[model samples]
Target: MAHRALVVRGGWDGHRPIEASDLFLPFLERSGYDVRIESSPAVYADAETMAETDLIVQCITMGEITHEEVSGLRDAVAAGTGFTGWHGGIADSFRASADYLQLVGGQFAAHPGRAPEPSGEPRDDANFLDHVIELTDLGRTHPVTQGLDDFAITTEQYWVLHDDLIDVLATTTHPVRPWHPWRRPLTSPAVWTRDWGAGRIVVTTPGHDPEVLDDPNVRTVIERGMLWATRTASAS
Candidate 1:
């Protein structure tokens, strides 16, 4: 039977959830996945639906998830359903739910180049910029990142609050920007993987713009990550 996948997308429109998700739909379909796309978080609350799913691809950013919704999704992942997503869609999602944050293993703390003014004023400057991504030894060896070289991409460099239990795949240094308060360069994980119960989770911190998703390297990483995650789910 074909693997079943659920793609939940919505929340902040700045991430271009629909466009980003759409970019990968053809790939998923051609890979023999029975993909279902939903715009509502309520889909997460359906226990029967969750139980039947082999993978969950989420693109909801900075949104709220209910107790029931989180519980159902958590149970599915814990029972060996694969979960994968990129950028704010995964890391910056569900700001109010610690349970959801803990399951994903990271939360967006800040991006170094821009910060709110001390006087609580918003700046008109661009938040996204270019940076180099260096793969770790683990990333070089992992299936998701194997055969890939260090690449530079222009996007939001997400600085995340993450769990140490995760396997770091790739990272980038925070460039010294005038808005940043730190005096030195700080490295942040750009991609990672973790296990929850019998399931697998993969996160990539690029893809802030639709064009970023179109990058061949970025698409390769995501495609391999999804396949790896789906395989894990099937094995479970």
Candidate 2:
């Protein structure tokens, strides 16, 4: 049977939710998934729909989630539905919902750079910088990062408030910027996985732009992670 996947997107447009999600749709379809796309988190409120879903790929940035919606999503995952996403879609979403934040295992606290005078104003530097994603010992052995070497990408380095339960796969160091008063480089998790009941979760914080998703390394990790999550869910 074809695996069932749901792609729910929408929130802060600055993250280019539509374009980023579009890049994954074709790939999911090609991978033998019966993909369903929704623009709202309300879909989580549908118990029957969530039950039928094998995996959920969320692309929503910062957004509010209703209590019922959060409960529905959490219960579904805990019952063995695989959940995976990248960047703000999964990590930075549902800022006000602690339960939702706990479900994902991390919350985006900040990115270590100053925005222009007006927020969302385009800058030549684009609020991003070059950084290397170093694989953890677990990453070397994990299916998602297998055979992958330390790679570099230019994007906003997310400083997340994370739970210790996560099995970190990869990490990056945050350089001390003039605006922040950190005395040393702060190491942050760039990719991670955790178990929710019988389900699986995977998160990577590098796909802020479509171009980042185009990178072979980033794309490969996400694709493998999704497959791993789905397979895990099906086995459960």
Candidate 3:
């Protein structure tokens, strides 16, 4: 059977969720996934309908999934489906849903005023020559970031707070912005993967803009990550 992908997207427009959702179509097609794109969150609510799905690619941010929807998604993944997404799409989704957070293994508490400065001087919301992260001890040997060197991108380097259970892939040291008074720099995980029962989940925090997705290296790694998180047995 051909592998399948269900891309359910919607939420904050600032992320250009639909456009972001569409970015994966060609990649999935090349990887042999029959992809379906949905513009709403109802995909999360339907159980029997989503059961046979081979992978779930979410782009929903800061939205709530109904209990029925959440339950169905969990059951589907536990039965061996894959789940993958990036940034606020997966990591920061459904703030009120603890079960969702526990399953995905992380949450977006704060970008730490990274979004806006106090004086309102628009920092590069897109690619800023900003420092990218160095792969930490746990990240160096991980499949998601193995052989990957420290590279800089002209994008917002994410600062994430992650759970202890996740296998980290890559990370960056974000310096304190003028918006933040504390001025202490912090190391943040930029990518990670975790298992949810029989399911595989891969999450990356680097894709905040289309250009980031356009980067050959970033695109290659993320495309591989999504495929890696799915049921593409023939892919390798």
Candidate 4:
């Protein structure tokens, strides 16, 4: 039987929701998933549609989700439906919905940029910075990141505000640059997973655009995550 995958995408255009989600369509199709794409979160409120879904891949950033919509989504995941996403699309989405944040286990706080010049002029390319995603012991052994070594990428490095409930796979550290108001270095989860009830969740803080996701290492991890955080994958 074919696995069911629903892709919920929209919100901020800078994240390239359509393109980013498109990158994985072929893979999902080849994986024997019957894919359905929705432009709005209203689809999440349809318990009937969500129930038939085996997995959900979301990519909305800074959007509002109604109480009814979030409730349906929360219930679906708790009942063993898998979910996975990356960057703002997942971590930065549904700012008004606390229940959504609790279910995902992480929230995007900020993305620190480079140091300022002597003139104190804002750099044109401030948000994107070079950082390495160092894998944890769990990442080295976990199916999501197995056999993967640390890799570097230049992009908007997310300073995520996350809880202890997530199984961290990789991390990135924020440097105490002169530009930012911080006394010491801080580390944030670059990639992580959570087991919610009978279901699983995966999130990556990189993927700001297609180029970032195109990085071989990032692409591999996301593809594996899409499969890893699924009801069928868990049962197997």
Please report the candidate that would top TM-score against the real structure.
Answer: 4
User: For residues 72-133, could you state the per-residue lDDT of candidate 2 as single tens digits?
Assistant: 99988888888999999999998899899888898887777654546666776556878899
- Candidate 3: tens digits of C-alpha lDDT, residues 1-236: 67878998888886788888788888899888889888776776677657668888999888778787788888777767788888788888888877888888877765653445568677654234466757767667767667778778766656676789888777777676665666788887778888877788898887776767777667766787877788544321
lDDT over C-alpha atoms for residue 36 of model 1:
98
Write down the TM-score for model 2: 0.93
Please list the residue runs of candidate 4 whose C-alpha ends up more than 4 Å from where it truly belongs after superposition: 117-124, 233-236
Candidate 1 residue-wise lDDT, 155-178, digit = tens: 778888888989999998886667
Backbone clash pairs in model 1 (N, Cα, C under 3 Å; residues 3+ apart or in different chains), count = 0
Q: Estimate each model's TM-score.
A: 0.92, 0.93, 0.87, 0.96
Which one wins by TM-score: 1 or 3?
1
Better of 1 and 2 by TM-score: 2
How should the candidates be ordered by TM-score, best one leading?
A: 4, 2, 1, 3
lDDT of 2: 0.89
Off by over 4 Å in 3: 113-129, 176-179, 232-236
Order by lDDT, highest first: 4, 2, 1, 3
Q: Where does candidate 1 clash, by residue pair?
A: none
lDDT of candidates 1 onward, in order: 0.87, 0.89, 0.76, 0.92
Q: How much lDDT does candidate 3 score? A: 0.76
